[model samples]
Target: MLRDKIINAISEVGFDEYKEISSADIIFADAVFASCKANTCGNYGQNHSCPPLSGDMDTNKQRFLNYDHAIILNKIMFLGEYYEKMESSMTEVFELLDRLRDQLDDEPVMIAGPGGCNLCDECSAKTSEVCRFPDQKRYSMEGSGMDIVTMSRGLGMTYNAGDNKVGFFMMVLY
Candidate 1:
């Protein structure tokens, strides 16, 4: 029932694509790319919500497993290159995430995304401070400890890695 409910909510999103996972098969996008890592993100320790600050994957998983179902929401960004695509695609991802968050008025949910979190222009990850927008910001999958390529395979989703790759996310709700 929870799974069906989440699927219904996702359908209302009109996203490029959305699916309900029996159990989350999440993977961080950077894990699929050899050159990427949490520290690799300039905002890594600089943002309260990103790595070097946010909790690790084991903790993240404990939280996620509490949920009965998860919904994977994705968009295909056809940007020109790596740097440019990260900017545009991530922006779109946050926008979509914001919309999704707005739609879930009473549902308690957690989302894990692609690369660095730009939820705020300047994150407190640098100052070793608390997050200003605990309700709005989320940690990227790789920023934690998920090996996305492996997770993708578990989900039966083939990750296509390239100079112009498509970024994605997974939101788990209890």
Candidate 2:
């Protein structure tokens, strides 16, 4: 019943593609963790849901593994010819992820999305303060060291949609 409920919620959120998998099947790699330290997205130590603040790789891995099942969801969006719509496209995906989060808010689930938590416009971590919403803090898939690209390929999900389109992924573990 819970799985059915989750599927319905995901459908309502209108993700482009989804796959159900055992939590154990989720992939984690040290290289992904290493990438976080590069701080290309600039959330490495700046967000509570991100690395250093979220915890070590081992901790993040164990957190996902503690769950029995996971649903990987993705939404594909088209960038402009020159990839100029990157920001807006990312915003749309985050909004979709937020809707999914709201739809399943009452359920016991852990959501890991494309980037750091955006619940607060400016994370309290930036001010060296405690997280304002610990319970609602969103985790990041790549930030947590999950090799999303590889996982997506293995699941036959779309990481690239061609024609200047790309997929943003998220996961709900329960």
Determine which window of 10 residues in candidate 2 has minimal summed lDDT.
97-106
Model 1: residue 62 alpha-carbon error in angstroms: 1.6
Q: Write the per-residue lDDT of candidate 2 for residues 1-174, one digit (tens) a residue.
A: 878989999988798999999999999998987888999989988999888898888899999998999999989999999999998988998988888888888888998898899999999989899999897788889888899999999989998999999999999999
- Candidate 2, pairs of clashing residues: none
Q: After superposition, how far is residue 61 of candidate 2 from its true place, in Å?
A: 1.0
Provide TM-scores for the models.
Answer: 0.74, 0.95
- Candidate 1 lDDT, 22-135, residue by residue in tens: 545544343423334335657556765555465655665565677666666666666665456666666776777677666665666666666666677777666666777877
Clashes of 1: 6
